[model samples]
Target: MNREIMTFDNVGLAYRRSLNPFSEKNWVLKDISFQLYRGEVLGVIGRNGAGKSTLLRLLAGIIAPNQGSISKERGIRSQLLTLNLGFIHKLSGFDNAIMSLVTQGKTIKEAHELVAGVIDFSGIGHLMDHSVSTYSAGERARLGFAIAMQATPDILLLDEMLGVGDKEFKVKSGKALKERVQSDQTAVLVSHSPTTIRKFCERVLWIEEGAVKALGPADTVLDEYEETAPTRGNSPSKTTTATAA
Candidate 1:
């Protein structure tokens, strides 16, 4: 049996409606419960505004649940990878890579050592010295992804940031991501891409209207989800495949 890495028990999150003292609270997630097993690529599928990103935030400890609890193995590190990571607009891509690594608890020298791999993986070595403000969206996303991968967190919370860059880069990045997923990395992948979910995830959790509608084997849950929204499953985009270990 796989070891349990993290568990969410009836977790809930809410945001204030407004600054008004009498304003009502808006619940974003409610009664979410799940257990994450080590070395599993758990997919999270949801429609827009379904609180998918919010769920990743909850997993990353970026926010706390308003109710219930989340438990994790001691000293586990989780890194949330979004298209827009905290890159300083004025800083160079090289500098941003180091900064991101250092912020992930790596020593300065260690960050420097790992940054070479990040640069190579990103395929943005030529632009390493260029200020992030000058990078195109795809460029920025690639750099962020590279840094996140090199950081090597115990849990990687990915928020729809996969399949970055052009066709060639997509293929390369997908291969690298596949290697990680097939390894002992526990990841929670949130995506609207059915192809991505089907290809990479062993099991899936479907969220609808900010609640878990279903959680089960990838084929079963995705079959049900696609039945509800046929076009979503058929949505066209670049896709890659991997065996879920």
Candidate 2:
């Protein structure tokens, strides 16, 4: 039996400069290869503009690779979850949940049945009755997240998308994902939170400048990243790492 849930084979993704076609393509990710195993939470760590989000989109099959291919077992359901976007803004939160779950292959009846659980976890309270457009940014994020939790895909692609509600919700959401991974559901998580990765991930992959920098045990990968990564405070981003050398 193949234990791998997804295999990325020398994958590369690039986008052409719209203004200058003859110019070199802006490569977002390059020569990426990895095997995601069943029931594993593979944490991805990288600095800003490191193509972490691009990698998640590739894994979710939302975009095609410019080179090579990503192979997965036939019929495995995969979905991307991100707090930055989701839900129909004009629709009520309840309507958005129903639409999302139905689009994920659930029947209307089935989706309606799952509404209670979504509401309970979303913690949006009575605000769910209003149009999502009327919600605060954080409220929108919470609603989107609640709808996503109704379906448990075979492969969950998380792009730095931990819950954006109150501190308590963030804690509970993190624990919920850990539970899902423990139950033999696979996931790829991209997060800046080293503590979250340290607590939940079995392994880690670090990407830098569109390429793999490291991939291994969580502690080892995270340790190497922190040691080499440039300071993130008042200093310029690339200044510390390169100038110090």
- Candidate that scores best on lDDT: 1
Steric collisions counted per model = 0, 0
Number of the top TM-score candidate: 1
Off by over 4 Å in 2: 19-21, 231-245
| Candidate 2 structure quality by residue, lDDT tens digits, 87-184 | 78898888888888887778989999998988998888698788888888777766666666777778888776674667887887877777786678
Off by over 4 Å in 1: 230-245
Instruction: Give the TM-score of each candidate.
Output: 0.91, 0.89
Sequence-dependent TM-score of model 1: 0.91
Estimate the TM-score for candidate 2.
Answer: 0.89
Residue 6 lDDT (model 2): 87
The worst-scoring run of ten residues by lDDT in candidate 1 lies at: 236-245
The lDDT for every candidate, in the order shown, is 0.85, 0.78
Question: Candidate 1, residues 1-245: lDDT per residue as tens digits?
Answer: 49998999999998897898788989899899989999999999977877899999999998999999999999999998887676898999999898889988899999999999998889889999999999998999899889888999989888877766798887887787899987877889988898998988989998776777788889877877777684443332322131222
